[model samples]
Target chain A: MELQGIYILWLRDLKRYIRARSRIIGSLGMPIFFLAFFGMGFRRVEIPSLPQNITYIDFLAPGIVSMVVLFTSTFSGISIVWDRQFGFLREIMVAPISRTTISLGRNLGGATTALIQGLIMIALSFLIGFKPSINGLLFAFVFMFLIAVAFTGIGIAISTFMHDIHGFQIVINFFVFPIFLLSGALFPISELPKFVATLALFDPLTYGVDGMRWAMIGYSEFNPLYDLAALLIFCVTIVFVSAALFSKMEVE
Target chain B: MEPIVVKNLTKTFNGFKAVDSINFTVKKGEIFGLLGPNGAGKTTTIKMLVTLLKPSSGEAKVAGYDVVKQPNMVRKNIGIVFQEPTLDLELTAKENLDFHARLYGLNKKRREERIKEVLKLVDLYDKANLQVKKFSGGMQRRLEIARGLLHFPKVLFLDEPTLGLDAQTRRKIWDYIIEMKEREDVTIILTTHYIEEADKLCDRVAIIDKGKIIALDDPENLKKMVGEDVVSLTVNDPERLIDELALEEIRKIVRIEDRLELSVVKGEIMIPRMVEIAQKVGVEVKSVSLRKPTLEDVFIHLTGREIREESGKNAFWRR
Candidate 1:
């Protein structure tokens, strides 16, 4: 019954996502814009610390894919606030399923949507002058999936405490901008000031960006195994935290 | 066991008692009502019973499962239609029902069958393919009702089933509720502020006020507790008229503003006597009317205030 409940919830979200074509297109706008602007605007520029073998797009493509997953996954948590405002959360809360099952289902759905968006960003990156090793593509998918699951968990955890969409938007923006800025997505962390580079170490997306860059372009600051391990721990911790917080949530 | 048993069920919010130790039992297959004005704790009590909110103290059992200790069991056996519409507006009516059916762990074959059956019961089968966002207020409500019964739950909780609907739509919803009771043979507990809704639909009603159950009985019996007939008179100098009309036939007279509501054994016989007494007392008789006691009159007789007045005040506060 719990599995069935989770499946139904996931299926409901998927159906809603598929039906909202404008939302899908709208959400892709920012990532695609970032990709084209940075990939084209800096086509001839040379960063001092960048690897000699790969162009800037190779270094920037994986980071843009990570950004897509990060933004889409975290924003998916807003659906919880939406469901609460519209009264659908009450229906799910009173169901026979456990809160853990409900949270798991929602996170899985969010992760699936984010993963799809990340894949689209990857495909779009190819149209630009981005190049990737064919053999590393599968590992890139693994890192992307991890990024989606972990950040969607974070989004759900944050959403459990939020009641309104406007507040969630403000809070998410506050967190997302700082996380994305410090994530080494645009520039290498090694080129940053000492204190700022240390801050990048705390940003979870930094590891995601490192892991995906290693997979796609065979270039990374951190070891790929270490990145994979850090993401796994983050995923487990966030999933548990979200489930606990959501279990304690009550609707009026 | 009864479908629901509540003992000293209390819920307090920030030290303000929302449901103050209310006790009641709902027999199997009975239509029970928790009738109260807005902010009168009806929804709070339902929330406790449905396992959405924990009770601050006391205990309640629904479908033979403790709400506090065995909430999942209680949830499995009960269906709830919240006061607010809970359907996914983006989904079609049929998809919403299918989602609910799947959550209840209904088999695929049974899911299809019950979805069709329940939607047809609410007369929404033809519109099942349309998105709920396109539905009118009344249609959305009917679809909610259909979804609530999709799982064939042992106990169904409907909070304000006909709230905010037009008179005709309200009547249609009431008809569906009554027919559902007969056809499904499931115990139902609903909350409403509408006196006519309670009087027409419930087998027994518990009238709650200020987080307390003030009266509980069938509509007919509750009215009988007031008197045979109620005579309402708007006369000048109501105090003087009350003093003049001290007859054995007049059981009780309650003063509400400038009007006097007299609970009499035979209102027809007392109306003329009361009017003559007013005439003799130099008090001008403005108007007089006699009718059998209704739930509203009973509420006024017990509380010394009009239920509608409380509702109106609540409406203002809500806005």
Candidate 2:
């Protein structure tokens, strides 16, 4: 857990991202575009009972930022698959380092990249007429980091099960997209039916989005304390599970 | 001291064993060659020794550390160059060596010194700052060897080191390998399909096939086991030739479709007498050649098949 190792891996990740300019933008840019268009398009739809008279754009901003962190972290897990394919994983594995160090370094690298992407989306939100308190902005940063760590683990776990790139894509489209939709990244969980709302309560991304929205727009149907607590529990559990499963993950 | 020792080592994939129960020891400052066909388990055996693949049934100790119980220690004591290119193409040659140096926890001054020395060792010092993507295949392979040596491990494992190189480049690599071995006194274990490569590079060789090692001895002794020389002659008459050469004096005579292979003590003089006898029997001689028995002949004698037949069975890196 040397910070130097983490920093080296972080630099490696950023360098890789910068090298693939179109991919970096495409992965983060498309989501920002949606945040802008939808935030503006839905300006008139306002919830009557919400405190602080939060606008629709302001309400959607936090969710978009959370989605940016989630997407970047999940996609970077595919990079692990590429590493395995290109023999890079073996190169690293053969080194005289603990497997835990290797996994931690990679996950930290992925999470850091996701946080940077989340920041870009947040900056973009300001240009699109969304407003939040300074305290809320700080909270958004912390929430994004936690979401990045949790989703990165889930993403890597998903990658371990896939045998090829095509299978990885199919998994993301089928599993990840549904999780995002069900977690209220596009719509409010309160508007869903009883069974769906109860199920959404269990979605880890739901807790993250709820906590972030509460911090940003200062309005929520669920208690912010509960949301924060659920997110912390979810993040810790996913991290442990991913680390344990990583030992059994084989390239061949 | 022995650099590598195996006690009934084996690795199985599902129901198929990739490395069967095999045991051998490599002494310090020695080059051990694992000679085999494509699917003859050389790579698997090396992987097990390098602590990359776990043995399914037995045990191995590399650099005096048990491969299973102390895998990290074993890995620390040995450097491995894989069959495929593993260097980061985007990184410069110096950067690649620097990364390996850091992985091995070398200090700054020593890391820099070792980088320069290893670059020179492989004769790539002038191209130290050049990116690997721009380097030729030979240069890239040389850089990989340089990186593997950065840690100054006690042993080095090279899996098919010169597999795809041209003959001239392959010879250059072999020269570097010999230089490295002499300079560092490092124990080297390499696997190869080329017979001459093993004969030239290894002090001793293990002939493996079908997940089993058929024989283990020095190259000279292995060749001697098949007799001193083999006289290969292409003859048109087969039945009459077999009847004529099937004398009690000859130890072994093998007949292919268009060739007669005979084991003899002095092939230089015996070849002429055999040709004279063939002419007396009116058997037209197409071509004649005589030489000492090679590692290929040793392999063929052990397995009853050619080395080229097992090339396409294993798809590397496939799940």
Candidate 3:
């Protein structure tokens, strides 16, 4: 029953995303712009410890894909706010299924949408001279999915308390921009001051960015195990918290 | 088996008892209504029965399953058309029904057949592929009903199903609803403030107020309890008119704004005498209208105030 629910709901979200041509076109604009300007502006720059063969765009490409996942997944919470306002959430909540099932469906659905956004960005980056082996692409898929799950969980958790869509966006943006900036998606965490670097260790996105960097550009500041462990732990924690929070959402 | 049973069911929201201890039992295959003004806990009561809200105290069962302890079982037997619009506006009508069916774990073959059946029931089969946002308000509501019936639930909950629709649309929806009940053999629990709707559609009604069930009976019996047609008099001077019209032996007189509503068994016979009294008292009778005794009169007889007055003006389309 739960498997079917998650499948159907996940399909529903994907179907909606596919149908909303404006949304697909609109959400892609920021990530593509960041890749273009940032990648182009920093093209010649190279970090000292990074391999000499790696260009700035190559370094930024995987991080940009992770950025797409972060923004898209967190923004997926907007659907919950909308579902509440439009009354669809009530239908789902009142169904025979458990709240955990409902939350899992929604989380997986949101994460899938975010992963698709990541894939699109990765493909776009590939066209603009960002190259990776098939093996790297496969691993990037896993890392992007993990990142998607974590942020989607964050999004759903935030949305449970937000009655207004405007308030939801304002709050999610509070998470999205900071998580992007502080996670060293735009720059290396190695260059940060001591306290800021310490904070980066706590930012879940930092692990995602480092994982992506390792996968795509063959660079790593820490053992890949740390990234995998940290992201998995964060993903599970967020999912648990989101499922608990979503159970308490009132119909009215 | 009885489709629904409630005993001392109550729900409190932050200490405000939204659904006070209410007891009722609904026979199978009946159109039951929770009729009241807004905030009278009609919606709250339905929420509890549908397993959307938990009772703060007491017990209820739907489809022979306890609502609190076996909410999933209760939900399995019931479908709800919420007071708010629950359809996915972005999706087509068919997709909405299809998704809801899948959520209920309907297999593909049964899902397809039920979708076609329900859509045809609501006469929305032709517009199955249209986006719900593009559909008229009435069509959207009908689609919602179709979605609710997708899984063939044993009990269907219509929470103000006809709210915010025009009279014509409401009537059409009512016809579809009755048709649904008969065709599907589903027990329906409806909540409505429209006295006429409760009178026309509900086999039995429980009039609620301030989180309590004030009266429960078939519409005929409840109206018999009041047993008076409502004669509303818009007079130039109501205070003087009431004093002069004392000979009519009015059962109840509720003064609302500039209108005086008099309850009497023979409103048709009394209007002429009321007019004569108005002339005798030198108060110009602005307008006089006689209405048959309805659930509204029953409500006014019990509550001392008109139900329509305090209810929010959210349904501006009511007229």
Candidate 4:
């Protein structure tokens, strides 16, 4: 019974993601544009902090993939606000299932879509002459999924407290940009000043991007094991917190 | 045990008492109504009974399960159609029902069968594959009603089921509600400000005002309390006509602007006598009409105010 509730919620999200053809296409435009402009525009530039013979495209590819996951997963929380506004959330809240199951189902559903978006980013990177080792693709997949799960949990957690969709857009934009920028998705955090590097250490996406970089291009500042552990902790904590908050949510 | 039982259930928002302590019960397979104008706590009481909101004091049970202590059990036994549209517009009608069925833990065969049965019951089977966004307002409401009954719950709570629909559509929805009650054999609790809706669809109604139930009885009996019939006459010099036409058959007479409303037994029999008395007193009778006492008259008699005065403004706010 519990599993069925989770599966149903997940399926609903998947169906919605598929049915909104314009949204799926529109959401991909920004990440791909970033990949092309940043990769080609800075292809000739070099930094002495780089490790060995990795090209700019190879370095920017994994970051772009992580960015796709981060943006899609965090933005998925807006659906909860929409559900609240449109009255669909009450239908789920009034159901007999536990809120933990409901939250888990929604988190997993958002993560799955985010994972798909990341995978599509990876595929699209190949068109721009980006390359990664064949054996490391599996590890890259794992890091990408962890990134998706962690941020989707963040999105759901934020959405449970928000009642207005327009207000949520303003708030999530404020959070998403800072987290993405500070996580070194656009540049190397090692080149930053002492205080900024320390701040980067606090961002969960720093580990996620570092892990993906190590998997996709064999270049990373932090240890892959440390990155994996941080993401796992973030995923578990956010999932539990969102579930607790959702259980206490009231509908009028 | 009854399908629903309440003992002094109440809810307060901050210092404001939205739903004061009130008690009522609903029998098995009965169509009970909570009738009131806006801000009268009808929605609040329904929310508490459906386990959506916890009461501030007292207790209530739905389908034999305590609402506060056993919310999951209460939720499992009851179905609700909220006042607003709750359907997922992106999903097809079938997909929406399928999602609901899965959440309720219905298996493959039963889900398919019940989905077909309910869609057909609400006359939406032909549009089952279409996305709900494409449906008109009346069709969407019908689909919601169909979805609410998909689980065949022991109790169904419909909050303003026919609200905001045209008169023809409202009547059609009423027919479906009545038909579903008989065919499904489930207890129904509906809230509405529409007097005709309560009178036509409910087996009994609890008329609420300002967080309290002012009256509770079958429509016929409640209207009977006002009088058997009411004779409304617009005559020249209504004050003099009132003084001259004092009869034992006329139970009460109240004068509004340019009209005298007489509460009487057998209003048809009293109308001719009233006209004759007005003629004898040299008072020219401009208009005379005889009709049975409606629930509106009862509401006015008890509250000393028209329900429509408050409801008309509230209806605009709802949109």
Candidate 5:
């Protein structure tokens, strides 16, 4: 029963995104472009103490994939706002489904979109000279899924509190952007200011990026096990928080 | 049995009561109307009873379930058409209905069948495959009604369902709604600012204004409360006539539209006296007409204001 609901919602989400070709391009195209630019820009640049076999672009591919997932999942919150403004949200709210089911369905839908975009980015990364083994690809997919779910929960949680489209956009800019920038998606946490680096440790996206990057290139500042564990814990926390908030939200 | 009941139901917003201890009941399969102006509490009361908003202090029940405690159950049995157009503009009318069917947990085959039935009922079967953005405003409203009926809900709540539709389309939907109520034995509670809509469609109506219900009864009985008929005389000076009529033995003088409207047990007898008095005082009588008092008259008599007075006049096509 749960799986069916999840599949239904996931399909609905994908259908909406696919119907709008521009949305698909912006979500999937942006990440691939960033990956290509970075991969080409540092293909031959040698670092002072880096291993001979490691290339900067190859090291950066996994982080870009993780970033793709993050962006897609976070923006998925806008659907919730749109649904409210458009009256679809009320239709769902008045349905007999449990509030938890609603949260789960929406989160899973968003996670699926993020995962699909992440895979597309990974496929493009291969074309741009970043290569990973079969096992590495599998691990990256799993890590991307986890990150997607986590970010989706964060998106849902934010969605419940927004009353208007403008308010929702403001929240995305205030919270999502900060979380994305500080998650070490484009740069290492060690490269940030000490206080910012300290704050990054608590951000859920940090674990997703670090874990996916470690899976791709086997290089990360944090242990892969720790990162995965933190992400799971964060995902659970976000889902529960979102479910509770959604249940408390009135449909007016 | 009462399918729904409200006892002292009140909802306050920002320290102002939107629904002020309003009380009413609806029996099974009955059509109930909540008639009020733009800022009146009709919508708030419906929202509270539908469990969309918690009442400030009072309580209500819907479908034998307490709106506050068994909200989910109440939601399960009731469908709603909000004032605003809520259709997913990007989806075809059929897909929109299909999505609603799935949400209600209908099986795939049953979902498709129900969608088809409702599409036909709303006269939208031919346009089902067309995206909602391509639909006319009337078509979109019909699609919304179709969506609301997909689950065979026991009750349907329509908040201003015909607010912005053309008169012809509005009447067509009213006919469809009445047919649905009869054919399916579904109880329908409708809230509307249109006085004629409430008069023509509702079996019982509660006149609400400024958060309180001023009168509740069958439309005929409520209209009778105003008296046999009303005499409206648009005089050059309304205040002078008000003072002049204040002294006369007129039954009740209600001022509306810069005119003096009086409800008399025998308005035909009182018309000539009023005209003579208007002439004596040099009050230029623009015109005089007498007709049976309508729900609008009842609203003014009870609330001391016209039903649609406070709100901006809605151009026929603007709504």
Candidate 6:
């Protein structure tokens, strides 16, 4: 029954995602913009320690992939607010299944869609002269999935407290921007001042960006295993909290 | 045994009573109604029974399962159509039913059969593949009902099932609602502010006002509480007029907007006497119309207030 509930919900989200052609263009557009502008502008600004053949675009490719996951997964979680506004949440709430099953379905659906969006970013990265090995592509897929799961959980948890799109957009503006900026997606955290670098280490997405950076460009400040562990723990905890909060959500 | 047994169910928001201590039971296969004006707690009461909101106090059992303690049990036995449209407008009619059926743990074979059954019951089989957004208002409402009955729930909650539709469309939805009830053999708890809807559809109605059930009985019995007929008199001095026309047959006298509505057993005999008293009292009788007691009249009789909103603000909600 749990699996069936999850499957139905996941399928519904997948259907909606496919139907909205503009959403694909919208989610993909931001990452490509960041990659093109940063990749072109920073090509000559070399960091001290350089590997044999990696360009700044190749270095920024994985961070942008993580950015893709961050955008798609979290926005997918915003469907909760839309569902509440449209009254579809009430239908699901009154059903005989546990809220946990519903949350799992939503997170998985968001993660899968985020993975697809990440895949698109990867394809887009290659087109823009950013290159990674086949092994790196496979690694990027796994790490991006984890990042998507974590960000979607965070978004769903945050949305349970938000009533409308305006509140959600405000939160996305205040919350998602800081997470992305502090995760060292644009610059290496090692170059930042002591306080800012310390703050960046605490961001869960830092691990995500760093882990994907290792896979895509073979450059990471921390051990890849620690980064994976932090993301895994963060994903599980946020997903659990999201489901608990959602179960208590009110409907008028 | 009754499938729904609500006892002293109460809900409050920030110290304001939304649903204050209401009790009633619905017999198996019966069409019961929670009839009240908007913000009079009709929707609040329905939400409580459907386990969408927790009551501030007291208890409710739907399909013999405690709404709070055994919400899943209550949910499994009951299906609800909210006052707002809860359908995934992006999904096809068949897909919507399939989604709901899967949540109820229906196997693929049973899911297929039930989807077909409910779609045909609502007479939307041909349009089953069409997205719900493509449906007209009436078609969307019918599809919602079909989705509600997809799992063959023991009790179905229709919250303003015909609300916001044209009169012709409303009548058509009514046909489908009644048809769904019989075909599914399910007890239905419908909440509506539409007086005639209660008169035509409900086997019993609990008329809620100011968070309380002011009257509860079958439509006929409730109307009988207001006597046989209502003779409404518009006069200059309604209070003085009532004193002079003290007919023993006059069951009740209510003043509503310069008009004195007299509920009487013998409206025919009393109308002339009322006119005579108005002349004697210099009441300046302007007009009088006698009509049979309807559910609306009964509601007004019990609550002493009209069902329609007079002021832009809701008096009940305004502390």
lDDT of 6 by residue, A23-133 (tens): 899878878999999999999887765554668888888888888889889888877999998889888888889888998899898888889888888998999988787
C-alpha DockQ for predicted model 3: 0.82
| Candidate 5 residue pairs in clash (backbone atoms < 3 Å) | B164-B319
Off by over 4 Å in 5: A1-7, A167-174, A188-196, B246-249, B265-272, B312-319
Q: Give model 3 RMSD, 1 decimal.
A: 2.2
For residues A122-203, write the lDDT of model 5, one tens digit per residue: 8888888887765877887878988888888877777777777788667657887788788877667887879989999988
Model 4, A114-209: lDDT tens digits are 999899889999998899887898998998888888888888888877878767657656888889888988788988899999999999999999
Residue B319 CA error for candidate 6 (Å)?
28
| Superior candidate under DockQ, 1 versus 2 | 1
Say which prediction, candidate 1 or candidate 4, comes out ahead on TM-score: 1
Each prediction's whole-model lDDT (CA): 0.89, 0.81, 0.86, 0.89, 0.82, 0.86
How well docked is model 6, in DockQ terms?
0.82
Give the per-residue lDDT digits (tens) of candidate 3, residues B194-269: 9889988999999999999999999999988765688989987888777777664687787776788888888899
Candidate 2 local lDDT, A1-252, one digit each (tens): 544455455566766666667777788776778888887787677654444466778778888888888888988766777777767677777888765666666788888889988888887788888787768878877778889988888877776776567787686788677778788777788778889989988788898888888788776667888887888888888777776676677743
**lDDT, candidate 6, B237-299, per-residue tens:** 877876776767887888887888889887888888888878876779899999999888887
Q: By DockQ thresholds, what CAPRI class is model 5?
A: medium
How many Å off is the CA of A124 in candidate 4? 1.0
Predicted structure 6: clash tally: 0
What TM-score do all the candidates reach, one by one?
0.96, 0.90, 0.94, 0.94, 0.92, 0.95
- lDDT string for model 5 (B31-61, tens) is 8999988889888888887888888898888
Please give the distance, in angstroms, between residue B294's alpha carbon in candidate 4 and its true position after superposition.
1.4
| Fraction of native A-B contacts kept, per candidate | 0.86, 0.43, 0.86, 0.88, 0.53, 0.86
DockQ list for all candidates: 0.81, 0.48, 0.82, 0.82, 0.53, 0.82
